[model samples]
Target: MQACANWIDGGPQPSRADQWLDVTNPATGAVIARVPLSTAEEVEQAVQSAERAFADWGCWPPVERARVMFRFQQVLRDHFDELARLIVEDNGKTLAEAKGSVQRGIEVVEFAAGIPSLGMGDVLKDIAPGVDCEMIRQPLGVVAGFTPFNFPVMVPLWMIPIALACGNTFVLKPSERAPLAGLRIAELFAECGAPPGTWNVLHGTARVAEQLMADPRIQAVSVVGSSPIA
Candidate 1:
């Protein structure tokens, strides 16, 4: 079976833990691959990596960041079908559903590509006689996201692109059961010139979530999962 590893720092790296979780193809009930169940320390490392990257990424000019996002959007569009197929193989969703789901993800990236404008703050001109009031939007450092298995591409795309576009480095912990899609997304981000440590994917079980929630380095945690898991 293929061993799915964590996307740490800037590249694909195997989890330190020997314990593995089986990734099944829901359509065939077959064990297609195995993903490492990362430990708390591994999660911490991922967070630290994000934190380390935050200053540079967060300080990048909005247009530069948007350019990278624009490239990412094009790359996503070019390989949209292959990504949807991976989602289908991993999540066992219908090809049409997978395509639609991945398209929604690409849409979010498209939205993120406009962050230069979308993330702009309003200005109150000449407030109080020569004094101006401005509403400024800032990027939180080292944000984290926990995604579900069902709509892996769509949900995470909703979180990551916007977060990275807003200048926050991201640490994503995708569901172990359908992780290949997320890993591939990380690879594409790098291929499209996204900086390492800016988008990291850590695969694991509940411990990963606990660590994310407890970590000070993770400024925010966004999740898309069932209430039972929430």
Candidate 2:
């Protein structure tokens, strides 16, 4: 069986973990791959990588960041069919549903590509006599996202593009049940010339998510799940 590796820094690395979770094709009972139950140290490494990248990424002009998103959107388009297939395999959704999910994800990327305008701050000039007020938007240091199995591709897309377009680096933990779609997305993002650490994928279980949430380096966390899990 194939073993999935974490995408840390800019590339894939096998986890030093002693345990893993199986990724089965939901349509059949076949085990397609194994994803590491990544160790806390590995989780820390992901957070640190995002933190390091944030220094430069956060300073990039919004237009430049938007340009990256533009490239990513194109890349996603180029591999649209393949992504849909992967989603179907991983999530057992119908081919049409998978395609719809990927399409919605691409739409989010399109929105993110407009961040240069959408993220612009406002200035209230001469509000009072000789006084002016301004509001400026900035990227938070490092952010993490925890996605559920149901919307593997679309959920991660919802978080990643906006965070990166706003100039923040990201670390994502996709659901252990269906990780391939998220892993492939990370790979395609790297291929689109995104700098290392700008976006990363760490595959693991809830323990890994807890580690990420507890870390001080993670400035914000976005999670999708039921109230008990949330």
Candidate 3:
């Protein structure tokens, strides 16, 4: 069976984990692949990688960052059909549903590509005599996202593109049951010429998420799941 790998530092890497969980196709009882139950140390590595990249990535102008999103948008379009297929394979969504989900993800990327305008700060000239006030936006150092099994591609896209466009480095923990779409998307993002360590993915169970939430290095976290999981 195929073994899924983690995307770290702009490329795929074998997990250090000694244990793994099977990723089965929902439509059938077949084990399509195995995903690592990534260790806490591995999770830390992902966080540290994002933290290191933040120094440079966070300094990029919003327009330049948006340009990366634009390239990513194009790359996603180039592989649109493939992404839809991956979603169908991993999540067992119908071909039409998978296509719709992928399209929704692409739309988010399109919105992220416009962050140059959307993320602009505001300035108010002289409310009081000779005084001015301004609000400027800045990137937090590192952010993480936890996505559920359903709508794998769309959920991760909801967080990854916007966060990166806003200049925050990201570490994503995709659902163990359906992780391929997110991993493939990370590869496409790297091809868009994003710097190494700017985006990373780790596959595991809930413990990985706990590690993310407990870590001081993660400046923010986004989770899509049930109320208890949230």
Best by lDDT: 3
lDDT measured at residue 136 in model 3 versus the true structure, 0 to 100: 93
> Per-residue CA lDDT of candidate 1, range 143-190, in tens?
889899998888999999999999999999898889999989888998
Better of 1 and 3 by lDDT: 3
Q: List the residue pairs that clash in candidate 1.
A: none
lDDT of each: 0.88, 0.90, 0.90
List clashing residue pairs in candidate 2: none
Q: Tell me the TM-score of each prediction against the true structure.
A: 0.95, 0.97, 0.97
RMSD of 1: 1.4
Q: Residue by residue across 191-230, what tens digits does model 2's lDDT show? A: 8766799898898877888888888888899999754443
lDDT of 2: 0.90
Candidates sorted on lDDT, descending? 3, 2, 1
lDDT minimum window of 10 residues, candidate 1: 221-230
Cα deviation of 159, candidate 1, in Å: 0.7
For each of the candidates, give the backbone clash count.
0, 0, 0
- Residue-by-residue lDDT tens digits, candidate 3, 16-47: 89999999988887999999999888888888
